[model samples]
Structure formats: structure tokens, C-alpha cells
Target: MSPQEKAGSGPAKAEICRAFSETADAYIIYGNMTDPDLYYASRFLASDSFTYILLASGHEILLVSEMEKNRALKESCVRDVRTTGEYDLRKKAAACRDASFGYAGVIEELLQKENVRKAAFPYNAPAFLYEGIRTGKAGIGVTLAKSPFLKARSIKSEEESACIEESMRGTEAAMEAAIDMIRKAGVRDGFLISPGTDRPLTGAEVLTEIDRVLTEHNDLGDETIVSCAEDSADPHGKTYGPLRAGQPIVIDIFPMNKRSRYFSDMTRTVLKGKASPELTKLYEAVRKAQEAGIAAARPGVTCADVHNRVCDVLEEAGYDTIRSGATVGFIHTTGHGVGLEIHEQPGVYDNDHVLVPGNVITIEPGLYYPGLGGIRIEDTVIITENGCRNYNKAEKVFEV
Candidate 1:
């Protein structure tokens, strides 16, 4: 058995330490932990220092700045926390090969005192420090290793699921509001203002209105998509333009509710004018494909299977299924695990990852055509013992 298994709290830490130790005797996780996006301490405290203390069998030390000391102490479970200036000013500064050469020197000294020889860290390790270590001043063998952090992140804990569920409710409300605005805007009177205001509720207006509604509700992030007409051909296009009467509008709003940093992503297509037969057929295909993808999500199925089944449905309808890379019938992956980070592990693509009961992913299947338009139907889902539960409450019916 591994050293971690002998001193186990659970698999999350165990997996992390095991991956690190395989590559090195020590790990230096460098990050601007202060960045809210990097370590959303308020939402989920999944920090490297915390993992090291709980998982590493040998001594683990953290080299932090003076400013982050108190926050790290309150948030991290790591005990061996020391500041960058704690070591000798000149010696530590020399040891710091790059910007934080002082910290690097201190880390090397700490490892030496602890008799650690092998060390690992991410690619962003300081250039000078890495070179110095290679030259033998650090007295440790170093290698970079990809930590299995996201795999552990894929499964949601009870508290995390609750937070995500709450975020989902906010997203559902915003979607309904956008639908309402679309209805009202369709009936509003306006004249073609020419190059200036040819369209009253142009594509840009609809997109902005949706954001306006979500902002009123609170805790919604700024990232939103409001694409219309040919612009919708790009799966993630949100350019400045107007909404034409005959074109389809794709409104995809996914924001983190301010109350909780958790996120919810959902997409819907609305046609402002009469829906063409071709447009209706494409929309129907996307809807049925999303349903099929969700239906295939269960505790025992693999992510690739769910993706393949969805592709089958779209291919049957004679839409472009295979992507040569950028141009694709389904340009993006079927879905991704969601939690503290919107896109995490258990990728819904042709891969080996298995679906577990606690897994939550999005089921978004879409078809895009250049100069024509695009249609995508997405729903966030959770895998249950026998099936899945969709979190989206927005109606799937067309507005036209």
C-alpha cells in the first residue's frame, strides 16, 4: 500500500499526493491565491496547501507572502506556513532564481533540511529558479507533473450540490425573463432607423436586455451570449449587431449568482418572426438530440457513450456530424462536469472516464450553418442511480 493509503482521510487527497509523489519528492504549487477566480475561498476551498498537509506523508511547507498570511491561516489547513522574507535576505534572494527567487531559495533550503530530493511544480515555475535547481544548488531532482485535481473536483459533495442547485434556480429565472422581454420586444413599434436604428430590438438589444434582467436578480456574472442570424453560426459568438425579423436568436446565459459563486449554464433558441420549415426541422433535431444525450446519462454509462448517442440522432437527420477540427456539426464537446469551476472533469467526449452517481454535467447538442443560423439546446443534469435529473426549468417550445 502507498504511504497516503496508510494515513488516509479519503481518496481526494490520496489521489492528489499519489500523483505528485510519483513525479517528485516535493511539490511547489505556485498561484496568485489572492485572485478570486483562482481560489474562490468563499465558495470551495480546494487549495494546494490544504491538499498537501492532508495528503503528503512527509513534511510539507508553504512559501507565502506576508500579505496572504492571515487569509491562508484562516482558509488553509496546512500547518507549516512560512513567509517569503522569513529566510536570510541575501541568500534567499539569490535562491529565488526568478521574480520570487527569495521564495525559491527558501523552499530549497526547507526541502534540504527535511532531506527531500525530488520536487515537482507546474510549468509556470520561475525560469531562473528552475535553472539554478538543475545546476545542483537546490540539491533536489525536479520534474513537472499534472495533478489529478480536476478528477477529484468532478464529484460534488452535498454542500457543493446544494450551492449549484441554488444557482440553477437563479439561471432559470433569468431565462424566463429573457423570454418575456423577447415577447414584449416583438410587439413594440419601431421604424428602420437606417444605418443608425434600422432595427428597434436588434440582436444586441435582446442580448443586453437579458443581462439587464439577470443583473436585477443579483449574483450573475457578466459573461453572456446574444447571437442572431449568421453570427449564431459560431457556437460561442456574441458580437454587436441587430436582431432581424426572420433570423433565429440564440440566448445563452451562464453566470455565477453573487450570493453563491456557484454557476449555472443554459441555452435556448428563439425566433422573433415566423419560423421557417427548415429552421423548425433543425431546431427539432437539436431538441431531440439533447433529450437523447440526457437519457443516456446514468451512473454506469461512460461519457463517450452519451456523446455518441447524441451524435447518432443528429447524423440521422442528415446534419454535419463530423468536425474536421473547427468546423463541426457539434463544434464543442457534448458537456463538461460543473461545480466550483464551470468546466471540470468527466468530459462528455469519446474518452475512458466513467459516469458516477454524483456527477453533474451539461447536455448541450447543437447544429450550426454558416450564413443560415445555429440551434442549440442545453440543460444541466445530475446522474442518479438509474437515470439523470435535468436542472433547467425553462420551456423548450419556440417563441415564434
Candidate 2:
């Protein structure tokens, strides 16, 4: 088992320790409010800025607000948690004319106490914090290094996989409820009618039902798509308006667990009634292409190769990608990695990323046409040593 799996927590501390050893004398993270790296490092959610420093001398320190210091001490991964008050930031701020420079001076004093002259930070660090470090009189040198941390986060631990799987279960249940709503609706005057009501069903109503189900399971459906017909042709179109019978309806749900902070994505195209010959052909082609992509995703396989497999299957069926100026075919990449962020790393595109065990990715193949609508089949899976284990359990039936 890897160190991350053995720790039963987030990434191993040794990993961070090694980053400090190789990247610089110390590694610093300024804020956890929107930084996944800080959250990963501390294992605690902070809505404000805090300092997280890991020294090459095998020491970890977290400087948080007084209101959060006790909570951080209890919930954080690191052992040393101190409040900013302990550093006398107000007294230090009085020394510098610029408030930003004052904050940097205080941090510089703390680093000097530890004898740290060289440090590293995330490449996407906040501009204010980067400027502070650059202008501070401590003469500390900083390197923008994010690759080591991103690489560590790319391969998930067993516990992280379980969290993702649990999130997928709730997502799949919500998808089932949405499809059931469509399956039980009555067809009237070329529009789907809500059961026991004369009003026509709308995509908004379906999305409402989906969100209701997800909320019940402690998941939030953010920007869920329940598009139909022409709307479905545009991949990211918002769900709206009345639903018509015998037309393609693309239902894509990406829900995140409120507690675990992991996301799950799944999509399926369904028709209220019989589908036209052209729509049926498109659905079959997309489904086969998705299967090809999934089959090609295995340990030691390159992500580009997996994407090419899907493209080959689609092109052979007389549908080419939009990149080739074809308006109604595969327009997007095959898949992407999923974890704390909906889109993570190891993107399954025409890139050189090699698939490995513990990598969780998605395989979604789609085909869209202006007049006929769109068809997409997606499932989240984990790459194993030999193959991938698919987490999506929803059936792929076009006609409801």
C-alpha cells in the first residue's frame, strides 16, 4: 500500500516533508479559503486566510485566527497550531507604512526565527501574498512550485476512493429519480404532461426533483443539466422550458457531498417515447464509443490512446469531431479526472498523461446535431491494475 493509503488520512506528511526538502528550505501555503492545497495540507476547512508552513527540519506550523485556533488544533492534520495573536501581528503592523507589507514583515520575522531563507509556494498563489513575500525586507527567496503537490493529489488513496464512491451512489440515485419522473409522465398534444396534472412538464421541474433527491442524501446538485432537443445540442446549456415527447433529453448531474467534499458525475440521454432512426443511430454510436474509451482506459495506457479509441469508433460510424469542422459529432475530449475538484488531473484527452492505478476518471462520449438533438453517455470509473471499475449503475435506455 502507498503511504497515503496507510495513513488513513489525506496525503502523507512525509510527502510534504519531501517537498520541503527538494523544492526549498520551507514550503508555505497562505490561504485555505479557496485553495485545495491548503485544505489538503491541513485537513480543515477555513473560510479565511491562514499561514501553513512546513520546514525542512521536519516541523509543521499552522498560524490561524484566534477564533479558529482551537478548532484547528482539534481538527487539523498538523500538531502545531498557533493563533496569529501569538505572533503580535498588530505590533508588527505598526512598524510598516503599508498594511500588506506589515503582514509580510510579521511573517518574515516568524520565518527568521526558524532560520528559513528559501521557501516555495503554489504557482497560483494569491497576488497579494506573492507581492508581500517579494517586497518583504527579510530577503527570503521563494520558488513557485505546484507540480509536486498536484502530482501527489492526482493519485487518490483508498479512503478517498471510498468517499468518491459514496458520492456517486447519491448522484446515481438522483439520476434515477429524474428519469423516473420522465418515465411516468403522460404524453399529450406532443408534450409530456405531469402525472395527474394538465400542465406540461418542464426541464426545470425535472431538475427541481433531482435537486430535492440529492439534498435528501446530503449532496448539492450545482448547475445540473436537464436539457432537451436544441438545448441539448449545446453541451453546457441550462435546463429550461417544456419537454416534448419523442425527443432526446440529456440529463447530466454532477453532485458534491456537503461533508466529504467529493464530486460525482453521470449523464444519460433519454427519450419520452419512440426515437427516430437517426437519433437511435446516434445513441448507439455514442454508447459504443464510450465503451471503447472505457475499455482502453487501463494501467499503463496513455490517456491520448484512450481518447483516440473513442474517436476511431465514432469516425468509423460516419460521425466526426467538431474540431474537423463537423457540427454534429464528438466535440469534446473523452474524459477527465475527478476528486475534490469536479475536474482534477490526468485528463483523458489528446495529451501524454499515462493512466495508472488509483486514478479516478470519467469516460463520456457524445454526438450532437442541430436538428436531431444530442446523445451522451458518461460514467465515472477508477483505473485498476488491469482495467477500470465503473461506478455508474444507471441503465442506458434511450426510450422511456
Q: Which residue segments of model 2 deviate by more than 4 Å?
A: 1-23, 94-101, 322-327
lDDT of 1 at 338: 78
lDDT of 1 at 251: 81
Clashes in predicted model 1: 11
Candidate 2, 46-156: lDDT as tens digits:
887888887876677888878998898777777888776777777767766665566676677788788888877777766666677766777887788763566666787
TM-score for each predicted model, relative to the true structure: 0.83, 0.92
- lDDT, residue 149, candidate 2: 60
Candidate 1 lDDT over 1-400, as tens digits, reads 2211222235665666676776676655555432232332112143332212211464545455566667656654454666666666456566444445554566666667666777775565556556555555756887765644556667766666666788877677777776665665543342112133334655566556667766776747566887777888889877566456556778887877665556778898887657789888899999999989998999888998998888889888888774335475667788888766677777898887889987989999988898688988889988877898887877887655
Roughly what TM-score does model 2 have, to 2 decimal places? 0.92
**Model 2: lDDT of residue 354:** 88
Flag clash pairs in model 2.
Answer: none
lDDT of 2: 0.82
